[model samples]
Target: MTPEEWQAVLLSLRVAFFATLVSLPFGILVAMALARWRFPGRQILNGLVHLPLILPPVVTGYLLLLTFGRRGTVGQWLAELGIIFAFNWTGAVLAAAVMAFPLLVRAIRLSLEAVDPGLEAAAGTLGASPIWVFATVTLPMILPGIIAGAVLAFAKAMGEFGATITFVANIPGQTQTLPSAIYALLQVPGGEERAMRLVVIAIAVAMSALLLSEWVSRAIARRIAS
Candidate 1:
């Protein structure tokens, strides 16, 4: 790959990595809450979490721009705190994270719902604290779901284009990720070859993520069975 292509790949990786890392904890927490708790507005919260998946990407991006744009309400406050997201790498990360969040939440929530409450009760009977029981028993049982969620998020981030470009505007070498780079290349007269290369890279990245998720899920299943 050319320097520019390599740079895009690396930037894409960096953005996806950080986005997934930052959102994983929150995703898990939300999934657990939705699966195991009963609270007011729980249904509303669930719908909101899945909104990006149903809404048009352009609409999601526009909403982000409105809420987090430079002159936007939250953006202005964040800017004063020395954090800027508009049209930057951070914005790209935010867009990716938002778009990928639903998938992560769904995967985790499914696993959480499937967990045997009896196991937790057993741990409690053994005098294990709630937190300790969760850490030692619940987490291990749900490891497959976590891995699946992460992989799904990573794949979604890799293919993210609409929301990202709408929010970040495709600035090369900074906020430009693989999908955006491919879009930009396709727009140029002689950019087909480069765009094709990036497309291949995108496919490879997505396939690898899916394969890894499947492998991890199977491993976790086997471990649990044993």
Candidate 2:
């Protein structure tokens, strides 16, 4: 791969890493809420969390632009604080995180739903606070699911293009990720080879993440079982 291609790969890895990392905590919280709690506006929250998945990527990007652009409502406020997302790599991270959030939440929520409530109640009866019970008893049992969800979120972030490009404008070496780079390359003649190479790289990276997630999750499960 060319140097530019390599840059895109590296930038993509960086963006996906941060995207998954930043979103994981929120995903877990949201998942736990959706799975374990009954509250007002629960369905609304769930729908909002999954809206990116349901809406067109372009629309999602446009909304991000309106909300986080330098002159945007939230963006203008953030810009005053010297934190900008418009046309920057950080914007790519935000875009990827938002786009991949639903998958992460879904995976973790399923796992949470599958967990036995009695285990948590037992811990509570033993004088454990809700937070303590979750941290000590519930969290460990959901380790594999968390791993799976994070990996899936990372993969989704790696492949995000439409929202990313629309929000960040595909600035090479700054915001051009693997998917955007591939898309850019396809726009011109004699670019197919490079595009194909990037495509292969994307597929390889995604597959590696999945396999690693599976291996790690199985290892933890076996250890827990034993």
- Flag clash pairs in model 1: none
The most accurate candidate by lDDT is: 2
TM-score of every model?
0.97, 0.98
Tens digits of per-residue lDDT, candidate 2, 89-124, equal 999999999999999999999889888999999999
Q: Over the stretch 110-224, how does candidate 1's per-residue lDDT look in tens digits?
A: 9999999999999999999999998999999888999999999988987888999988888889888998889888889999998999888888988988898898899878886
The residue pairs in collision within model 2 are none
Q: Where is model 1 more than 4 Å wrong at Cα?
A: none
What overall lDDT, based on C-alpha atoms, would model 1 receive against the true structure? 0.92
Q: Best-fitting candidate, measured by TM-score?
A: 2
Worst 10 residues of 2 by lDDT: 137-146
